[model samples]
Target chain A: MSTSHLHPFDAALALASSAAGLYTGHTSPAYWNMVGPFGGITAATLLQAVMQHPDRLGEPLSLTVNYAGALAEGPFTLQATPVRTNRSTQHWTLSILQPDAEGAPVVTTTATAVTAARRETWGVGDMPMPSVPAPAQCKRITPAFRSEWLQRYEMRPVSGALPEQWDGSGDTSLSQLWLRDAPERPLDFCALAAMADIFFPRVWLRRARQVPAGTVSITVYFHAGSDLLATTGSGYLLGQARAQEFRNGFFDQTAQLWNEAGTMLATSHQVVYFKE
Target chain B: MSTSHLHPFDAALALASSAAGLYTGHTSPAYWNMVGPFGGITAATLLQAVMQHPDRLGEPLSLTVNYAGALAEGPFTLQATPVRTNRSTQHWTLSILQPDAEGAPVVTTTATAVTAARRETWGVGDMPMPSVPAPAQCKRITPAFRSEWLQRYEMRPVSGALPEQWDGSGDTSLSQLWLRDAPERPLDFCALAAMADIFFPRVWLRRARQVPAGTVSITVYFHAGSDLLATTGSGYLLGQARAQEFRNGFFDQTAQLWNEAGTMLATSHQVVYFKE
Candidate 1:
């Protein structure tokens, strides 16, 4: 929305309505409002709507949603189609539609999913668990200071989020935390996807530099031993993510999850955008 | 291919076939020859196949292929399908089929493609550039030195690839070089993806520590500029990429790309599977 062509109000109203349609797809707004505006989280919710829960050893894959357009302020509509559901992986396509004006079309984006059964290949790729005792024993940092948007999830930092150390006194630049599916819904990889995307600014200590806001998109590869103990509408969540990339305005992070025992679990990636 | 499985001939045949099928989705001894037991290069090739090329700007999109399974002796078949082609973004789905002789299926993986008409975003993200004037100003570290890879891309070392002092004159923790696309190609985002993946090993002076040999999968992402100008790529693929997380045989690197103006051209993220 710009003055070069369209009025701001016209664009905002149009975006709001389009956001409703874009967020919910062809469905009503009430359904999608429950689906947040965060593209990564929204993508997770879309995956949840189509793919059935993986039963005992059942690997019906649910298609994924890729955020083609950066997440902006407004409503969004999502469209999903089931391609095939087999024992190996459930496949589908999810589309996100961004609205403009009454007659103007919004940005539409989609992704295909392929969930498969667990197999062994010795991906052999595992980062050792932190030397820290536990998330409970770690310090606690208030999220309100940075993310007003993270209120949707119950976040309890394990290492309490490290402070900005000028001389690099930190032993580890990583952080860990436990969370609950807010609104108490069954947790899935979607939740993990959402959780990883928001874990950035938290990991990058706010050392008095201006927060350069930008967009982020993530790709998650769920491997064996990665699953949630949290029930769909109830349970606890554990998020172990480390900020590894913050070069220029582009940042990247990889996160892993596990119930306990330090067992390796689902791996997720987060790409954060920065505006200067 | 397995021993407890079906025909040995079929398994052996698929092994070679899958390797060749990786690049063109057609099996041949030529492609297989290009692929080897090296997982790092193999993974990079597979990612390139799935990545959307710039020449295909107006064509349909596809995921190309992702690492389904690598036996180090993989007969991996990479398959891709056009998801959809639209005015803005094109999507694709790619599958890598890993065959098994005794097992039902060795490995199956799929990835989504988001191909969009890219726009130019101008920025000088405060990143520094190497002092190298251009590729012509840089000298290739001879192949006689047995650095074939380094020769392909012009590496103008800010500090000689060797230690200045007997006790190690410079920071062993870091090294900077000017590297560019050799001989020039369509220099687009996919190539940008390729550039990022390869720049990691150069981050540190090869301190008698085998780098690439230990690296596994280098997952690279580009958040911005796509075009690799004949001059730009000719000047400096300047800047540096550093490892952020390394544990349990897997390490990750985040790369920052800078132009001669000290402007940030793009950013890259990659996960490397390697051992210390």
Candidate 2:
């Protein structure tokens, strides 16, 4: 009997059929070029596949991955797999694969993820999900600046792009226009994780304004799993942004996540490395 | 020149002295009896002395301690040493230590840290810090019924404590609270990081009354440095509490940190396992 239901495992990499959802994957200008960097959407989609769906096979999800190596602005495929699916928890590995000049593939990452247990004595009650205007009533932000790849996915920078914004000092914070699974497609949690990564540190720092780079780690926490298409907004709500360790080209900063209604969502922290 | 400059690296233990001011230590009933746990605060203080005070002739702090296979709590000590200091950046390591049962010494942790580099560029600027009063001035909300540990920390729950009525379906959600550096002690990014681990999650899950013990990973992002003592009633704000994943006897959540001015200071994500 072919089971239509995904196994308790194999859920981390919930496959996506299109990019019309909240965190959709888009191809880049230099798609065939293996040396170019991966677009934000690609990163988001990979994350969604790895973190959100790993447990479909009936297991828990647990894993971590670091960029062992990268060719700035490259093309790659993100593949997620279930490493171990147990009754208590499931573990998974998500890999970013770059196709060689010959169309052969090279692996870039493998993170281990696990699911934690729940406590019998529970406390922090849930914050009600903000009463969001139905997506149909929400406005959409336009992608001010576009890349060959960014064009495939929709993103609205909360602030209009700045010209000569590169030295890292003016408008040091960043807020993005609300864009999720596009109108036609829905994104998974792994994909959402990837998309949220774009929401951290201060994206404005990258508008050709700051020192090359002072970053190393980027971390994200998930609150409610969102269906990419169902979550929509034209404008964006900016949370908190902070810079702590910025010595040299390696720095760590944090930003808080909030909904359009101003309800706090999640907090994001990461280390960024500027290519000086 | 026999001169010393405090580094921006965060220390897990509250600072005893700083050019800013001295922060006296106090033992709260929360972890009162666990002060002597392996590699607890005792060791961290010695490490702090060597790292923070230049006049003290101490070898670089590095020691290994055994877990002895049991869970333990603090008074956790954070000791730091500058691995390298420069105008652009400084690298340091902080160790969390504890004393053994026989009063013997043991080392718990050695974490790498780096200070942020000064820059000329400004992309996005500062988020509005709250105009709220200092933490000490904030209204202290003590539930008619409260936990000893919660009291030791002096939490001013902005939304008030968990309600007395409960029907049993766990509804872990978001909570806002004012946290003062208790025992009249001040804390830096590192010390605050550890303290953050102590509460927020429990508060967000207020529906669950039991203490949580099952923890997998605790990731903290320090935005800038903060001395908790100088923080008045509004000094420290728990912006948002998020429950990312919760299953079995474990859960993972993230909390945003802000100064009284409402400046985003840091973000922390933790994986906890409540075995009891």
Candidate 3:
């Protein structure tokens, strides 16, 4: 397909290899958040660099990304290094850099990823997918916020949602919703990584106050492979997220994503920084 | 206290600074596992390097460690680098290296940590500590295995015990227990990090088979700071762990640690590799 005809998700994740283990990418206005590009898109783009590397070993098993600082809107450079490669697994360290006003490259993000050649074995899903209304039955939510990233996905809330009053009367941080790409892109590892961060900050829901918050670090464990993602193509995923504790200007939320077939696709946990 | 009089946990975590951001440490026989030292102690020791670093910005906010390979019994070198330091937050990258048979240093583990100068803010805990008997009321477990690490911690299981029969008829992977250092060491961040990994591989509990399994990557999010840990003192921590999904020779477990007073201390998640 022509570059212009490609889906927004694909175009946003496009990367060019300038040198070995080095990539240059641009920020997509389509996925812009309040401050910068969506954190999910940035995470997926970083994973894309490793996935595109010739030296990469099998598929992604786990990924951890830490946002050191918000990226300014512009082009950025990414470096992915394979620190250790074992017989069945490979470990990588990655970073994204953008030139500051002084025209010097500055690190804005850091990440570590583990990829492995997984083999079939005994498997089970202990966290069963909760029964909820089908996506077609639930009303799609259109957030009133101006974040461009929120408009790129179709969200249908099943439980916890954004507070209507913002009066600090929230009782819980748990949020459940059916979500998928707005333009309906097929499922893939990069897309799955992005989808894992679809949930908004849990603190906003827990406190019913619009506190300033952003993810400091996020870790995602992939339970599905390429074949599984293909089988779940273009389908709505049920996502559930909840904060365990919010203390000392920080909180953590754990989330699980399951496909229409009830297969658990991924589980993610993140620590967020919040200002009162 | 003299070196000889130090607690085993302290002795195991002792580090000698060889240079800036470089530390030399030895494995303690008290915490040895099947092939090497327990993963918990190794994780705790890695965190110690940053904690003791002169350039550290603040307390740990999050830590993710990837186990590339097992450490050989003996001495190892650790290098911690402050990749990005902001006004209130600092990001670090760390690795542990051990000499191979060829007398060349090789990387065996890699980690990333975030430390921040936290401030008081709105706080809440959604995951309440489950009701269970006090530590004195529960009987301690004595496993048939001969791993030295098991003897270092006093574990009182409240549920999800190891299978008595290996007939492949296992069920849930949830385990709740009261844990504390057997020698009665006070609680700290390092101790809490180690306790996060105290639960055995959840697969063994989910399935009735003793399979070969090890943690591939683990991430711990700290909710309590020095003050909270000090308040916890030498008291037992009630830990709960459960597997969300087990598939394709890999599974992830989520855990929470709470002090006797029902104060949530930390939450941890890990992805484990298993062989059929």
Best by TM-score: 3
User: A157-253 in candidate 3: lDDT tens per residue?
Assistant: 9999788899989999999999999989999999999999988899999999999999999999999999999999999999999999999999999
Alpha carbon lDDT of residue B81, candidate 3? 92
Model 2's chain B yields a TM-score of 0.57
On lDDT, the leading prediction is 3
Docking class of 3: high
Q: All candidates' lDDT scores?
A: 0.43, 0.42, 0.93
Q: Report lDDT (Cα) of residue B89, candidate 1.
A: 55
Model 1: per-residue lDDT, tens digit, B1-276?
243463221222232223322433323222132233222234334445545233334311222223333343434565544444545555554555555676544334445554445433322222345455554565654322343233334456554354433342223334455665454433444444445544534222333344332332233444343443333543556656654333333434455666554545555444333434
Tell how far residue B212 is off in model 1, in angstroms.
22
Q: CA lDDT of A252 in candidate 2?
A: 52
- What is the C-alpha lDDT profile of model 1 across A1-276, one tens digit per residue? 343453211121122123222334232221122233545555555555444323223332222345554434455555555434444334444566665557454444555544555433222232445554554654444544434345555566775364654442333435577665444455455555555454544223433233444333455544332343332234444567654434434444556654445534455655454443
Model 2, A1-276: lDDT tens digits are 232364211222334532221122323343212334332333444555644452444222222333334533443456555433444444443556566578766544323344433224432323333344443354554534443334333444444333354564444444434444333244344443444455433444534343334233344444433421136332343334444433223445555545555544444556565534
Q: What is the DockQ of candidate 2?
A: 0.09
